[model samples]
Structures are given as C-alpha cells and as structure tokens.
Target: MNPKISDSIPQEDKDFDKQHIWHPYSSMSKPLPCYHVKSASGVRLYLDSGQSLIDGMSSWWCAIHGYNHQELNDALVKQVNLMSHVMFGGITHDPAIQLCRHLVELTNPKLECVFLCDSGSVSVEVALKQAIQYWDSKRQPEKKKFLSIKRGYHGDTFGAMFVSDPENSMHSIYTSYGPDNIFAEAPQIGFDDEWNEADIEDFKRKIEKHHKIIAAVILEPILQGAGGMRMYNPQYLKRVRELCDKYDVLLVLDEIATGFGRTGKLFAQEHANICPDIMCVGKAITGGYLTLAAVISTRSVANVISGGRTGCFMHGPTFMGNPAACAVSVKNLEILRTGAWKSQVDTIEKILLKKFKPLMESGHRKIRQIRVLGAVGVIEMKNPIDVALYQRRFVELGVWVRPFGKLLYIMPPYIISEDDLNHLVYSLISVATDESLA
Candidate 1:
C-alpha cells in the first residue's frame, strides 16, 4: 500500500516513514496520527501545527529537567565531537565511569556496580538473567522462578513481559503459558490505606509457596507505572525486603520511572530505609537526552555474575555504555546533585495537592481514586473510555497527559514553574469532574 502523506511533511518524507517505519506499541493498520514536534524547551512541546503543549507526563516520565536544557545539550555536543561511540565490552570511557561513580554514591551503599543497557526493558532482562546466573554460579540452579506483583508493568521484552502481570497490555497471546515461572498478586499498598498485617501475611504465604524455586522478587517500588498508576505502601517494600532476605531470594527494584529525584528522593527505596539486591534504572538517568538504562547491584551480586568463566554478564547491546549517552548521564547527574531540582519537585507536589484535593474529596463518581507521590500524581477514572476521552481533552487543553487504561496521571518535568503546574492541576480537575466522561 502507498503511504499516506500529510501536508505538513514533504511527500517523500511521508512516503519514506510509511514504507519503513513500524512504531512501537502501535497498531500499523490504524495508527494514531503522528505528531511532528518542531522543537521543545522547558516544560513545553512545540508542534508543527504551531500549537504548544505542556509536557505533563515528561515525555513518558523521563524528562526530569525538561526539554532542551543547555547543559545536557552541551554535554551531548561535546561528547559527539570528541567520541561519539565506542564498544564498552573492553574499552572504558569517562562518561560511563563517572556516571557509575555518581550513581553508586547516590543509591544505597549496598548498590555499588552498574551495568549499562539501552532501555528499561533491557535492564529488567539483564537483572533477571543476572539473578538466575547468580544462583547458578552459587550451585542453586533450581532457583528460576520470579515473583512479581499483579498489575505491575515492567517493559516490553519477552523476559520483562514474562515477569510482569500477565493480564496487562502485552501478555494476551501468552495465556496458555500460564503462571509457572512468574508469580503475582494484587499490590498490597493503596492510596486509601497503608499495608496491614493481613497483607503482610498474604505476601509471606505467596513467598513461602514459591520460595523453594524463586530466584527473585521484582517490584516497581512505591508506584506501579503502566498499572493504573497504583501506589503501594513503603512498609510493604520493607516487608518484601525482609521476606526476600529470609527466603534467600534476590530483590529487584524497577525504578526506571521513579529514579533520579522523580519520587522526591534520589531513589524510591529511600522511603522505606531499605535497599534492593538489584535495581533497574532508566528514563531520567540521562535526563532524556539519549536512551540509557542501568542494572545496578551490590558487590555480592556482582561477584556471583563475574565469577563464571563466561566472564561477567552474558548480555550486551551495541549501544551499551555508549559514550554519548553516558556523557549526557554524567551531566544529568551533576544537575540533579544541585539539590534545587528536588526542592522544585517538592514545591510542585504541594501546589498540585492543594489544587486537586477538592476534586479528590468531591466524591465524583467517575473518579475512582487519587494518588500522589513526590512529583507524580494519578487519577483513576471509571473506565477506559473515560481515560481516552480525558487524554484527548487534556491534549486539546494544551497539556500532554497520557492515560494508562483507566488511570490518568502527570509526572511533569521538575523544572515546571508553579503557574504551569497550577494549569495542569486545573485541567486535570476539569477532566476528572466532567459529567460527559461518565
């Protein structure tokens, strides 16, 4: 079929995209019209149509410092000029080394090593493989099963999807596979209440049932992104840590969306005063300048993975530890260390809560629940249609707010000013309370 051409693009460009492009998480037969962003800076995206939109979701929760920051741009430019790419398997680069040092210092004391990958899904896959190998090298080959929480969203790769909640967006075809290697349950934490003893007992039961063969317990930390923006209790995390310790199972925390000051801290585990055996970090690691993710671990996990004759991790992406991405990450970390970004996030959270509190308490039937953590906030609508409608309406209202199933949420760039944040909250309130959505 000939490609459809938009007037905004040159006919050749349109044809080229239609002939060669297969977009991710999209239906090719009936694709959503693509946006041509001319440029972006601060918290706004300027489209080819000449309309400006607030990046309410931080371009999929990654743009921590916002778009087109001078420092990040300069870093990428400087690195590209010096060394654009290099194989990380044997060669070492300043960007990767410096970023790792910063990350080790920023994360828990136990997490001391970093393994670079291209994206969050790949990081999850790497961590899973590392855990399996850790057990195998330790002579516990039977430990292969992974226990995750129900409705948890990891990423799109096969291994990542295997560990995520099977009922989510990507697992329909794998129904026959069933729940043998993967174990899951409804999240124990909720916005309305904290984790209780019963919740802890149920988690313990699940752990005991699978403890013999379980290799690891994977979670999305305090908030489960792509799972209806569900918020869980940190106490549950503490309990999960204890259970993993007792059962000798590794704990893998997927902080791809929560890391780098997004959760009002350097990492979400800080809330519980606990640390995971392994952590998957992405998104804002490079401040959205380039694709990068890291599988960070303790000396113990590193030792196990490195001890084998295979000589450390069996995984490698061509772009792994790309100098350009790492250089950007080093600069991103420098920006975060300034401490001003976190203070801005805290202020934005306070303003958002104050503006949305009434809508949350209004008992609007279409709104099921409200959850806020650090700079991120979510509103669960009554249905999927409601979610789609709100997303579209919010876009028209000059804000880019994507809805996940029945959940509508915002994770604006930390640099957003109070005025922009207030606008976002009001727009969200309007959509949440609109009777037409019901």
Candidate 2:
C-alpha cells in the first residue's frame, strides 16, 4: 500500500491536492494521475510507495548537481540562519552580489549587467522589458515587436509567451491574448546535419522586412526545449547575430534550459562564438534548489534603459534576490566551476549516442528521429504515445521520464552514474521496442 502523506502534511491535504491542485499542463477538472515523491537523493527519486526511480528530467533540467547535494544544502542552511530574504529595492546582500558577479564573469565579457528574478519566465519578462525600454530610451518606441523562430520555447509569461513558437507550444490558446510577434521558420537542418544557406533565407527576409519594428530577436540558442527537443546548428545563431547587428536590433538568448553545461558548454551561445545583447538564464542557476532566474545584459543596454526618463528598470519581484536562493546559487556556481560538468556531460552524450543508436537505426518505422546533445537524449515517435501509461511503465521499471507530444526524452542530472544512465536508456528502449504501449 502507498504511504500516507508526509508526517508534516496531513492526509486531508493530499486528498485536497488531488481534487484541486492542478499540475503543469493539467486540467483541474480532469487531472492526470499524480505520483507522490517522498524524497530525492543524488539522481534518484524516492516515492511514497517505497519505490526508487532514477530521475531522467532533472526536475525540468535544473538540478545539475543532483538532489540532496551536501554543498547546496549547507549553503541554503547557512543563508536561512542569517536571513531568508530582504527587499531588493532598497537593500542589497552579498549572496546576490556574489552570484551576479559570477554570472557576469562566467558569461561573455560584454554581458555585464544582471537583473535577478524569481523564475525563468520572469527573467524573460525582464529581458523583454529591458529591450523595449532600451528602444524607448532612444525614442524608437515603434520598435516594439519581437522576431523569433518557429519550434522555439521561451517561457509562459505574457511577454515570453509572445516570442515562443505559438502553435507548437502549450500557449497556443493564449496566442490571441499575447502580442503577435513575428515568427520565422525553424532551421530545416538538424544539429548534426550539414548547414544550408537556404534554411535561413526566410528568417533573413522576415528580419529585413520587420527590422524597423522588431525590438529584439530572441531564441533558445541551439537547443529548443519544451516546444520540442529540437536541436539545430549554430550557424543559425551566427547568422542571427550578424543580422541583429546589421538591423541595429538587440539579441536575447534564452538559456534557461541550456545554460550551465546542459548543452556541452557553460552557455549555448559559446558554440556560435557570439554574445547576445541580453541573455536570460535560470533553471540550473541555483542547481534546482531554489526558484531563481537572471536576465543578464550588456552594459550598453543597461545604460540606455537607465539613462532614459524612467531612470530605472520598472520590474521587481517580491522575492527578488532572496538571500537563500542566491547563497545556494553561489555555492552551485562554485561546484559548476570545478569543471566536472563539462566532462560529465561529454560522458552522458557518448553513452546516449551508444545506447540509443539501435533504436535510431532499427526503430525507424515507429521512430521519427533520435537526437542527443550534452545530457539531453530524445526519441521522437511518429505519433504521440500514451503519456500516463508510459510514465507508469517507467516508474515500474525503476526509471522516471516524462513524455510529451511525440517526444520521449531525458535531461538527466550531471552527477548521474554511467550505470544509471544506461538503465534509463534501457527503460526507454524497452518502451520503444514494445508496440503494445504505442
């Protein structure tokens, strides 16, 4: 039998949650089955039913160091003892300062200014505001629209929602509610596929036609997450930078999913050897220990907005720069800087390539494509599989993976053992090989 709720949580609370608490992309009236996790350690999730499953999603690709990390734990504890939070409007703290400094230094040298926010979506909001304000400062308020690619996923907030690929994303219904931002075709070529100039022609034409009204060109860099686990070549980004420069438009790269070595680099823009005018990073920033995101910008963009009539950026979250989050994030950055993530991601990539090769080669009739980048491995099916059924199967098989749309993917924690990764691959293969579940 499954255990009751945690000692701290009443059984009634669990019952209430089932009836009222809506999960991501879930309907409140017809909720999907929910699993109860008691605790997590390293790369495994311990469930209330006394089952242990290797985590394949990394809690949506944030916990790079894995769960229950001693360093991250100690950092959070120490900060809580000092203070949990303080209003960032008038006050400042060393934890936030240190975290921002590390972020600026670790990113391209040109990205010097930082705005710490509560989540990835909020950081994107702040970036959008900064871009708009920068143009407003120059009296070019007409430069209000954004240009982005199809099959791109930024975030769910209003401004972020506007830039994401509407039809492919969950926010399609809200498209009518959000701004009608320009959309270009996603690169036709795959990440490993040879580049073709024709793939970017439509994007170029869109930008050239819309440059006057386009404030910024925002994208997920090389890897587009959520909308689909689509990975494209860096030359697309290279061309974006050149075009943005030519049109005097700001470039914003949303690295919320790809930052901090998730894409075989500390930042995905490094693959193109370019620096965006503004960048939004979150998810792994605090090692998934806390809700924290940052909008990093070049000093030029910062000065332009601040020097304008407003005299300051107009957005602030209540929990902006929570000391606990920053303190833990500082420690997380220290751990990431130790340089284990790079080699670890490389290993994960190799294992994924080796393990998934069979499915890619032999399962072509059922599989659409197989993609691997850094720690991310995805098997795209010709049609969407049964989500609840597949999830239950993975749980029973001692692995945890969340499938969405036609993609069954894993973005495992960096600290995952090679053996654990192999098991995850094995579980996925088992399902792909079983047509009954399809």
Largest TM-score belongs to which candidate? Answer: 2
lDDT of 1 by residue, 312-396 (tens): 7788899899999999999999989988887888998898788878877776878777878889888777777544455568867
The RMSD (Cα, Å) of candidate 1 is 3.3
* Residue-level lDDT tens digits of model 2 in 1-438: 333223455679777987888899887887766778889999999877677889999999998889999999999999999999899999999999999989988999999999999999999999999999999998999999999999988887888888988888888899888689999999863887888888899999999999999999999989999888889999989999999999899999999999999989899999889999999999999999999999999999999999998999899899999999999999999998889999999999999999988777776677888899999999988898888878878877888899999989999999999999999999988877677786
Give TM-scores for every candidate, taking all chains together and pairing residue i with residue i.
Answer: 0.94, 0.97
Name the candidate that leads on lDDT. 2
Per-candidate local distance difference test? 0.83, 0.90
Worst window of 10 by summed lDDT in candidate 1: 1-10
Clashes of each: 0, 0
Q: Which stretches of candidate 1 lie over 4 Å from their true place?
A: 1-7, 10-20, 175-179, 189-192, 309-311, 386-389
